[model samples]
Target chain A: MSKDNKEELKNDTIKENQEEIKESETLTEEVLEDIVEDEVSELEEAQNTAKEFENKYLRVSAEMQNMQRRSNEERLTLVKYRSQDLAKKIIPSLDNLERALAVEGITEEVKKGLEMVQESLVSALKDEGIEEVPVTTFDHNFHMAVQTIPADDEHPADSIVQVFQKGYKLHERLLRPAMVVVAQA
Target chain B: MSKDNKEELKNDTIKENQEEIKESETLTEEVLEDIVEDEVSELEEAQNTAKEFENKYLRVSAEMQNMQRRSNEERLTLVKYRSQDLAKKIIPSLDNLERALAVEGITEEVKKGLEMVQESLVSALKDEGIEEVPVTTFDHNFHMAVQTIPADDEHPADSIVQVFQKGYKLHERLLRPAMVVVAQA
Candidate 1:
């Protein structure tokens, strides 16, 4: 009941409360540190996983682009050669006309018909992406002259003088090799 | 300097050493818990990202298969109709053979030549996948009636009385519809 006793009790209560507060603070600090560490690791893992997915996505996208490009090439090829069937169908008509020209035809009407047929054949060949191979000189890329012979001084060697069998081209590709007699050097 | 003082100093040293050990243990436990949590979260996130990528991979693979299937179907259709060009080229030869057959009063040599021509035409048609449309009573699907007339009272209606133009099928598809005369009721 004295002043000293009361002061002593107050000090005791304050010290006990301070210890409890310190323990609670330590526990809270431990839990907070654990949470912070877990979150940091989770974030690091998420970042790594995202990077890996980005790589995979890039690879897949590149593959898709390549496939699309290939498909486009195939489609272009189809369209470019779409009329080849019809052109092939008409070639025999040209052959028959050539035969008629070779035959002995005395009539004027037949001659006119042959000329008309030849013109029409040329038009058809032009229409169907087929044209005569341009091989005035002996270049090896487009023309294949099967035969070679020695040339005179006036005519230059490696020049195309005689064409035995005509060369045919279909859409920038060699359909048949030209059978020609070329000058020998 | 006294024995009591020496003993008290020894006790204080022991207490301080034990406190240091306890502090170290608590710190170590905190560090270990943090590291474990970090490692676990890192693994979990990596696994989740891997799952996402796998699903994407499967989807792309399915798309690739579909594209290939579609392209293959287109290629097969192209192959089935590959001979159309050649058949068209040979059609004129067939017409000429027909004209030769119609010619009358031929010598034996001429007859033999005509037979040879006919044989060649037949063989060519066979090789080119060209077949005449089979006709019996003639359903409308394969035949077009160019003319119609009343049948004999005994005959059934829609009977094929005559075939004017031969119908032809090229690889199971009608190239030209057959012209016919049908009997009407």
Candidate 2:
């Protein structure tokens, strides 16, 4: 082949190599851009997953704390009202003993024995946070109005006139409201 | 400039361009490798964070469930033992009534009234899950061995001879262990 033709062919080959180099450089930039975009989306997805799990953890932690608080409150309330059921059952027997003491004609010995029993039972009830409903103001919360009477000057309006049966309470909880007569205007 | 010098200068320019292209190609490859490594490590870190959050969420959820279960159990126990405290307080009063009934020379009316009170109090206690501890066999759980007597055929070893003071129980709990004489060989 002629030297001129050989040189021309070599020049063509160099041009082709330069074009290939340019193409590869463009491809690198494109590939890097694509990779960065993919990485960003993947990182966002990972962050969303982490955030979701964190939210769930926080919610469950709050629920556990609330449950503990509620349980403690319930325990305190139960302990406070622990004697409620037994006190209710014993109140009637106390009423019966009081009636027995009220009946006339018992000898001193019998009346004394009955009085001792009555005092002890009442004291036991008192020790357990049981007490008769106060007969001061006619409060519906503690006193049930079985009968109502006209308000006289002596018995002011909404005042308790008479208690038919005693009402007892265990702490703040009313076991049975006092069946009573109230004076109303 | 001379034609030969111009040709040589053009050749030097081509060579410089080629070397620059080669360096850029190598840098592109190095940059791509570093980017992929960085992406892999970042993804791993993200995944690790997500896994950590998931584990914490699971732990907290389990804790919440366990707390709820425990709270239910505690509530049941509280309800079951609700009457225990008041019943304990009332037992001594019951003992006093029993002693009052045991006294000699009381009139029939007084005796009847005392028996009625005793029966009513006992019934109330039974309704509230209070009961006299069984005196069949001497059990330390429900019976306190205050006195010991020599065992005979009539009272076998480990049997109960007599209860000094009656013991009582509220459900499975011993409110007071019976003071008893135990028969031992």
Candidate 3:
């Protein structure tokens, strides 16, 4: 009888230990599930942060490009009009020279002075990148026909006959077109 | 005697407890000191970050101001030169009319045409902020004295004798000075 009682007590002890082991396994499963969920949320948060950084980079780059383009356009326009004030100052000198030459039957000394004045004008204009437009032949791009003159036997048709106003070019672009009379067939 | 021994043992136990409490207190103090250091570092980091932001703000603002100044200057220059090409275009018409009137005595019809042409020239120039500098008096700022002419009784000493060149103004600014002969006593 005593041996049977001892055996029963040992069996009870084993049963209680098995129950404790089962409870620990369930707790471990719960902890593993929580860890996996936490990892997924952390990954999502890191991805969101990277996306925000990329957006900021793109915005800044676009702004920088706009600033550069605006400055470049302004620089180009400034160069285009660089000779305005100087041209204003020099036109009166040209008019004075013209009036002096227009006096009927100019003296030899006055003619010499006029030549010098023309030379000075040419040099001053050249220094400022001012060039005369070509007008020996008719060119549609750089001449405006105010009149059409008939072609003679010696003169070729479509040739420029007279230049009413001299045209100027600044930096290879036409500042003004030559007002011209062209010969026609 | 036994009571005295018990009291001594009690005192030993109390001493041990006191030492343990002191050790725990020291550990807590060390932890608090580390936390304070971390807080100080965080405060310094925040201050440095704020200063960096301020520096960037100031640099961007200064650049914006420089760009603004340059843009205004360019716009003003564009306005000044806007009429230069147009003026060059119509100058020949005026020159042609002027040449026609220069012939030996003018008829009434010729005089009327000349007056009309002159009026048109004046209006065109005035519309573009262009004006002629006065030639009745000589001024060093707007006149170049080319010679000293002998004055008659009608003119005063040190006065302008004649204007060789007609001066011009663009928006109250001197474009050219009149070339003149001055009289002296």
The top-ranked prediction according to lDDT is: 2
How do the candidates rank by DockQ, highest first?
2, 1, 3
Give the per-residue lDDT of model 1 (tens digit) for B64-109.
7788788778767665665455454444444454555455554444
Candidate order (lDDT): 2, 1, 3
Docking class of 1: incorrect
Per-residue lDDT of model 2, residues A102-162, tens digit only = 7778777667777887887888888878899899998989999999999999999999989
lDDT digits (tens) for residues A56-139 of candidate 1: 766876787798789778867775665455454444445555555555532444444445545655664665567777767887
Q: For candidate 2, lDDT tens digit of each residue in B1-185?
A: 97566556656756877887889989998998899889878887888889999999999888888888988998998998888877887787788788877878876776777788888889988988889999999887889999999999999999999888998898898899999999999
User: What value does the lDDT take at residue B17 in candidate 2?
Assistant: 71
For residue A30, what is the lDDT in candidate 3?
Answer: 65
Off by over 4 Å in 2: B1-14
Residues B37-128, candidate 3: write the lDDT tens digits. Answer: 66555555555555555555556656666766877787786777655443443344344444545555554543453445455555756767
Candidate 3 lDDT over A1-185, as tens digits, reads 57556556545555555554556456645654565455445445545544454454455555656876887787676666566444544444454555555556554544454445445555656666677788999888889999998899866898998888777776676767889999999
Winner on TM-score (2 vs 3): 2
- DockQ for each numbered candidate: 0.09, 0.61, 0.04
Worst 10 residues of 3 chain B by lDDT: B86-95
